[model samples]
Target: MSNIGICEYVIGVIHDKDIWYYVGRYDANGMKLKPNEQYSSFLVDAKRYNDEDILREELESLPKTLTYKILELQRCPKCTKEFTEHPALSREDNETEICPECGVKEAIQAYINS
Candidate 1:
């Protein structure tokens, strides 16, 4: 299987043709090499093999921007209540949790009467 998400690549072999190259494969999980999971590739030569050393470097970087995505969305201006990712509010008749700051007071009043 191919590597998904972030993973490690293994240097399975080396090809010394006209161009010097280091071949390797992506390891699924962080573990000692196993026979079946191994694959092959042409990375950099001996001089730039340190490129593989940076494998774990990405983990040191800052996290994703998703937190800003969720936080940046506008909440209700009147009530300051953040809009959740849940389904939209149902008809007033079917629900009782009204946003007192923004709900139509007359509509809620009529529903309360009937």
Candidate 2:
């Protein structure tokens, strides 16, 4: 690759607004990076690799579905326990997964754990 390509690299999600985006060096195929990587609010389209135009073209593409699960504390109707970050999802305006069974489990576990 070129010097710019080796110095700068980006990672992004398939769909949904990225909560976390990462960017950093590619390690030069045989080097190591220090201090890990950096996070950015704006993400680069992963489809763009080697050719920025391809990524730019892919920017119009959207994933069929997208969802996010957050663990939050809640009292389970069954277990009556609250867990840390137990998810209590409600679909977002953009089709994000708002609630999930894992959230219920985590909430109950958190409640029990506490």
Candidate 3:
């Protein structure tokens, strides 16, 4: 079975010299069997700041120039893992409660069964 997926994006912006620049983004994808529920993935842009400390340092360096906010957070039903995006989950209706890794296993099992 094919599963459709949905995603939500949280954009991070920094105001420098009155110009707002997009520094990064967080993408959250819906989970299988729970289309409405979304989770955050570790995947992020902002190559200059890969770690939270670095990101914070850069933000703090600019003081009033930097600001950020999280739109939401979601948890994986199968693994209980929290993420900004669950790209591996399925948003299709009547889907099973399986994460991306487990979903791959399920596909293999189906292939073998067939």
Candidate 4:
């Protein structure tokens, strides 16, 4: 049997310490959250994708602005902190991806050991 599903767009705002706050979602008519509906205390708790390609394609189609960079929020597996910066490869494994801060720390540790 096949499963049915619905897809929607979401918006988030960066908050303290790079934490992302889920602001709202878009419906068939348009984006659902209005000015008064905005909030910043909540974290995004839902997985919003099944197909990565489709997700990227849809997000890329949205209009860009001079004020903001369009990107996906990601969590660094090493520190469990959220980040929007490009990840650096873990020196310990050279395979695991980590946040930029952790990468710098790793480099420093390596230098100390040498």
Q: Using Cα atoms with residue i matched to residue i, what is each candidate's TM-score against the true structure? A: 0.18, 0.20, 0.28, 0.47
lDDT of 2 at 21: 39
Pitting candidate 1 against candidate 4, the one with the higher TM-score is: 4
Q: What overall lDDT goes with each candidate model?
A: 0.32, 0.36, 0.40, 0.55
Candidates sorted by TM-score, best first? 4, 3, 2, 1
Model 3 weakest 10-residue run by lDDT: 33-42
User: Would you give me the overall lDDT of model 1?
Assistant: 0.32
lDDT of 1 by residue, 32-106 (tens): 444332322322211122244453343233134211111111243334453222223324455533343445654
Best candidate according to TM-score:
4
Question: In candidate 1, how many Å is residue 97 off?
Answer: 16
Compose the digit string of candidate 4's lDDT tens values, residues 1-114.
Answer: 122222333344344445343343553357675633443444444224546576556456534431122344566777877554678999989998788999999999999999
| Candidate that beats the other on TM-score, 2 or 4, i.e. the better one | 4
Candidate 2 overall lDDT versus native: 0.36
> What lDDT score goes with residue 52 in model 2?
48
Report how far residue 25 has shifted in candidate 1, in Å. 27
Query: Model 1: clashing residue pairs?
Result: 23-41, 24-41
Backbone clashes counted, model 3: 10
Superposed model 1: Cα runs more than 4 Å off: 1-72, 86-108
